[model samples]
Target: MKTDLNIINICLSDTPMQEFIRENRILGRIISAIPEIPFEKVKIGECIRKGREDLLYENKKTGAKHTKITIEEKCVYVSKVLKKVAEEHNSDFLILDGFLHYFNGAYWEKIDESVASDCISMAAEKAGFLPVEAQQENNKKKLLRQFIADYKCPPIQTKDDDLSISVNLRNGTLKYNNGEFTLRDFQKEDMLRYQLSFDYDPDATCPQFDEFLDYVLPEKQAQDVLMEMIGYCFIPTRKLKLERSMMLYGEGANGKGVIYELVKEILGKEHVTGFSMAALSFDANTRAQLSGKLLNYSSELGGKCNPDMIKKLISGEDVEVKTLYKDVWTMQDYTCKFMFNTNSLPKETEANVAFFRRWIILPFDVTIAKEKRDKKLPDKLKKELSGIFNRVISGIKRLLEREDFTESELVNRTLEEYKIRSNTVLFWVKKEGWFAVVPPENTERKSAKVPHVELDFLYEKYVAFCKKKGMHETSNATFNERIRKLFYVQTGSTNNATWVFCDKPKEKDIPVSDDTQSPKSYVERFIDNLNEEK
Candidate 1:
């Protein structure tokens, strides 16, 4: 009754007879036919009852069927069952059943295809079906991304070049002054912060440029800078090595608030959030909403922004961030450029030199009166946003044509004053008449000897200034080292370490010589030589 090769007994019979019998046997032929099944007819298990016990649970209080079940719990049980099947059959993948859609109290409901894909891909590695070892990378972010990408799904957009990668304006393309770069890697979620629409407006017209008006910036340089800010939001931040962030400062009504409001209108509420610099540094889960945002705006920045955040963003570093209920830290690009409007500057950060590189301090000098000011200015600005967007594109063109852009005199003066005030050591060096002041013999009183200062004496003044300003004082060794780097540290014959001016040459002024190098010793030696000659 059993099917076996022995039924034919080919070895015992003649060769011709054995061969003929073997050809006619059912087992001798390859599988030439397969039954086609209807799409709705197929099922992994006959009903929901056949699934794992974990899927069927009752709520403790409400007694609702399957109320205890959750995505997090169901995913674990599914991975175990799938992994067992994969190991037994050596299967690379499985066409999972429709049961994984969602658990609605008592039964499953269908979900979006993307959600289904995410559920499957997330459990792939733990199921041991993912060939991650072969790829030789274990980073969680890359691994998760690669698994989803490698598996077939609905294609949104594909981008291989990281640097060239940019947010798709949904306009189908991004046009610079010189060329057009089509948008790629257009993820709908990523654009949650791009809130501003860069949709090309062929019919949109820019308002006329007017001189002596505070509504739209009248100055060419100011106008160019504003364009760059708007244009960059459409482009990706990773494209530039360095960026300049703006801080618009002036009196009560210099149109700082209007400009800030205009930026918010252009970039929607979802894309632009009020950045409380103080709270941002201290608050938890602050970065959660900022993940996809292109710009962080603050109109009423009261004091100084945090230095640590500023330095990291300006340098294009990956910021370590966390959100509510998250156990692990996620790294996000500090791509969001900050725009601040305030009546005054905040407290100066200790690292003044590095901070100055990224800071663009612009004074809003022009103020408009009640009649002269456009009450409906914000509404008008919104209508012309598309035109302004194009203007920014043109600004990019100018930047490329000339390697350098405008730095107003106000910008230069503010930076110089910032450096002198914020930095304790630099202030003393400049004020000390080229790092050389005559040392008084008596430490008890003021020196009438000469109008110069000594290195040790200058250090005392530096420390006092820092304490009075509530700034941290560096160690004597560190202070000495920093000054030595700026100028020459002279060691006298007596093994006394003296400081002398380095006399760094410059174009504007003739280089200062080290006139106070020997001090009274030089004068004494000249007098002795004269006496010997007499």
Candidate 2:
């Protein structure tokens, strides 16, 4: 008996690709300019199989058991099986004309990557189009695929389990797993891209960021302006901490958490860590619970705390934790990127010379008047976007599989997915607004007016650490403490203050109580002496 091969295509139509539509709405306009590939409705026998027979197969070549058979029962289940077989046979053509089994509920188990890939390829091939992957040679970066294969998140078992929703900024479409919807405003994409890059590399070309925003905010200027405000972090500059730590303040609807979610999404959910600024001053348990878990966070946190503790903690100072349990933990140190959502930044904390010197405050006022939202996803663009998602997931998976990717490299690669650059990181120093430069302590803050304030301190600390054969700047907190201490000593405070800065803002000088200026500034003198010896 000749075995008949059955083909089933599962396409979610009329279900509203809410996220995809919102994004590629503009792309839809572009697509509309071009003629659509006509689709015809046809009917055929639906072969639904799931039983012991479906689970068993004999290998054609070896005459051995091919026990890894897929059982197809439900519409999605049957479609999935057909998809796999189509892929195994390298079927290049696929057509979905009529009732392709409507998804009764919103969330269903995702079809395997191979199935999605095969579907995308099949659809394109049938339309006489080449797969995007085939068009780009450099995209052969197999590491992305490997990464996704090895990657696992705290299982997102259900839609309710999804704590956040992300709009593809490129297209202005909402995305959650395979489900997508269209939206009205391009700014949502901008805000989301801002949110994602706000913590990671906020400076430039997040292809993922671009992919998200391209369809939504096509205006180069608008996207550029928004990105400038959100991109760039204070990694380290000249051996000193750059004053680039962030504090985003706005009302509830203003899109504060949106930035954090974007970062979380691209960072593979497992590698990216987040902390609520409020949780920093809350008890250790809360801090650990909020920061440690991959996704779940207490919604109660947004209202409970002020920004002062966050201010102090960012400056590398300690704060007391108010514990729910009787046992209290002194949770002061913070190294990971922090995202806080609140009505306003603490005023006094914002005004502090040290805090101001260290912090980069980006105000996300959603109420500020802007252009109206854009909404309209054409069928053709929706089809294209669905293809993009498949490629991106594939690319990322390939990146994760490479041998060259270290833990740090992998982290950076993940950030790139959202358009966050990892080459140089930005942090808020509590003294300045957001900056793109690396850790100043590591680089000797070129922008600092105070001479030798950063370097003199690093030198002294390094000497002491070497004498004891111990590294003092082990953690972000410890590294920051040394910098703040240097600022205090150089500026000459009467008591041990948490932070200090030079009195003269205009001059590149930090003066002590000596009242008169020295012949050579500390930084200048040190550099001169070192050069002379060399």
Candidate 3:
């Protein structure tokens, strides 16, 4: 993946402070508080040349026409202003508008971009511009984070915080607007698309709402998935990575396509991506297409799906992405969340914790009968696109309020399935009357075809089991290594060694099922007995 230096919180002492802004009292109060920060004073009059401005927060002071501070100033002025407002108001959070005016990058060459961003965050945290709930290490980081979380100062433009979606957060609700879908600047050459006069409500609905919901997908999870997709649609900034990917699995004639269309319509074709699951691992060019996307809705998946590649994509780790016409591969953190429609789960996966953690399976077990299928349902749902979009926006607010994603029964079931699939060895051992491995003191061995077990014989059973399940067979070496790692299970060639199988916890002991659940609940799964490749 091609990586961009998006956001960092490293404080730099040598960040230049020589550039002086045209003196203004506001700037004076701000700069005096943080002398290391530097900025040039820009008034509303200077911005009047554009003939139009979208920053609602940038209101001009009446009868105030200030002189221009023309010195080459560092972009750290944003941090200074945040510090001033925070200290004066004793506020825990400050609006994002004030910093947009100082995003001028003329001094970018003179300042370290990462250090500059941190300085801003530090100033904000010190000034108490960050919410109390947010983690705090220092002032500059908190302020910079506040900017990233609620950066609205665009049309309010800044290269430092370039994002497609414009977020207007009030109270707990965030009004996500600006479907223009491209960052714009005053310079004519930098423009990608014309700023259209769009007045559509994000919460708009289509005409065929009831039939689409009732006749199409009756499952509650289907609705939750659609609403969550809509919530994700409004957020284009990839600051907070989505750790889990959505999978819509069921038989044909279900309402998968309609849900996909609703999300595609609202987020626009430019931001959503579609590809077969197999391409994710092998096709560099295909994966390249997903570079700047916000969501990947995969429909047709080929037989061979690489779990490792999918794991990397969903985990928000560094990935190597290929761009067409570019010879060398670039590394980027592809934070786009994925949702795939498949008839059945892949027969095989790495079955490791890394893979399971990133996969959220929503089984469309309920298939809409052919008799109940509505041919015009897509068109009807299309009519209520506005309404569907509105529901999604509302969903995002709920997600923000809740902040917990793994609260579904389907998630629990999917995790259970992952457990069984990952530990194919354990599953097979239990299925057969294999020699049982108990604590060293407790001697018990379930009778099976072989009275005495050897490392090779146990591996033979594992190989046959994998073939029976249509899964790739793990090597004997790997199997024996896993046995050694699992404390309960011991494997060796010695004649005295016991041919015992380690018992897996019953369904009641499942990790996610515990009544008491929190972030720590996820850690319930200990390091598995399977030997993990570090």
Best by TM-score: 1
In the range 163-248, model 1's lDDT, one tens digit per residue, is: 44333343543433335434433333232224245565645656632232335355667667666665555555555544667788
What are the lDDT figures for the candidates, one per model? 0.49, 0.32, 0.50
Total clashes in model 2, counting residue pairs 3 or more apart in sequence or in different chains? 98
Q: Write the per-residue lDDT of candidate 2 for residues 212-240, one digit (tens) a residue.
A: 44444344433332333222121111112
List, residue by residue over 465-507, the lDDT tens digit for candidate 3. 7888777776776676554433234444256564634333345
List, in order, the clash count of every candidate structure.
Answer: 6, 98, 35
* Each prediction's TM-score versus the true structure: 0.56, 0.26, 0.54
lDDT of 2 at 76: 25
Compared to the true structure, candidate 1 yields what TM-score? 0.56
Query: What lDDT is reached at residue 513 by model 1?
Result: 47
lDDT of predicted model 2: 0.32
